[model samples]
Target: MTDSRATQADIAACVFDELKAIVANLPDVTGCAYERAPTDAQDLPCITMQTLDGAPVERRYLDGGRVANYRFALLLRKQDQEDQDRLDARALLERVASSLAEAHVELGASRAAWGMTLDTLPHRAEAGAGFADWRTELTLKYQTNR
Candidate 1:
């Protein structure tokens, strides 16, 4: 029962599919893919996906089970943190909740993700994100079928 053949592409596709299923399966999302890091260890794999506008959603897989825990990261511009942008996180949370509500049963197959943890960091000005200072990371652990 080993799923070792699962590629970064496979995990990313699942992430994209579940994420897109949120907000009514909108087509606004684009550029979804996983990046293989030479430094990544064998047991833990990761992937990153970006929206058409360049915003990103990232996930990292831990051990397999009924609930999977994934870290969803997002990089937003400093300007995007304006008062208007402050609501962005809440909105996204609501979207995720809606996704969970609509697909709870379907999510029975999630076998991954029990809860989520989120954090944000401000990038240095020299990092090319002169205007994009915020890096938000979310750790989502779900209910897996162990």
Candidate 2:
């Protein structure tokens, strides 16, 4: 019989794809870029995903696997009025959190080989002169056996 276990990359890809799908469907999100930093040319109200670092989880069994982390940033254009920008950013931040919660349910139900948690960092309007960015990190723990 073929092995049904998952690898680190497989779990990472699954998480990324699921998150991308969820975020892309959110209101006002123009684009979702995978594994890349946002650039000036990217459409505003966009999200970017990049794979960060990972480490093996300490376990009593040799068949245990590693945990991978990914960084996700939501970018929006800063309006001329400060309050408007802040409100817009805050709404988007809430939407992102809600999306992550939905993703948790979706990912958990669909992928039986892995588990994920999301940690949202502070929101910042300092992503440059004209952009507000909200950042979050996703941690995924999955088996690496074959």
Candidate 3:
């Protein structure tokens, strides 16, 4: 029997959903969404995630498992009252990283074995009037046979 591989959209959806769930329980995050947040949405701490890319790597014929490389970008926008902006952003980014590191089963549509790597540290930049942007990139190799 051949194992089914998840499509790009399916993998993206599962990752987005899992991020949403994880961010919901995180403190200081007002919302988490795929792509972008609504314009009319309140100016608060939020996380917006997007799939950068995914490409086929290799396949195991014996187990019918496929390997793929995926890249995801997480943009964390935080509104801070004081001058500890960079610190705040880094804190949130750390939390996000920790959550993702522990995330194996919640990765996506397929039953995947993940090897996650952080491609970049959170970069600090101005977002809007009082908001700061912390952008982080993560790379993952997902191997799934289910």
- Whichever of 2 and 3 has more TM-score, that candidate is 3
Estimate candidate 1's alpha-carbon lDDT, on a 0 to 1 scale. 0.36
In Å, residue 102's CA in model 1 sits off its true spot by 12
Clashes of 3: 0
Expressed as tens digits, the lDDT of each residue in 1-146 for candidate 1 is 22422422344455556644453343322222333212222311112333222222233335533333444544322223355544553354344444433452233344443444443342322122212223345444445333
Tens digit of per-residue lDDT, candidate 3, span 63-117 = 6566766677888877755768668878788689668756863554444746778
Q: Rank the candidates by TM-score, best first.
A: 3, 2, 1
Ten-residue stretch with the least lDDT total in model 3: 1-10
Give candidate 2 misplaced runs (Cα > 4 Å).
1-6, 63-81, 104-114
Model 1 off-target regions past 4 Å? 4-11, 18-68, 77-112, 121-133
Predicted candidate 3, C-alpha RMSD: 3.4
Model 1 lDDT, residue 89, Cα: 33
lDDT of 2 by residue, 33-130 (tens): 76654556447666666556544343324443333233334434432248776777767766665565456523332234345555654366455656
Alpha-carbon shift of residue 140 in model 2 (angstroms): 2.1
| Ranking of predictions according to lDDT | 3, 2, 1
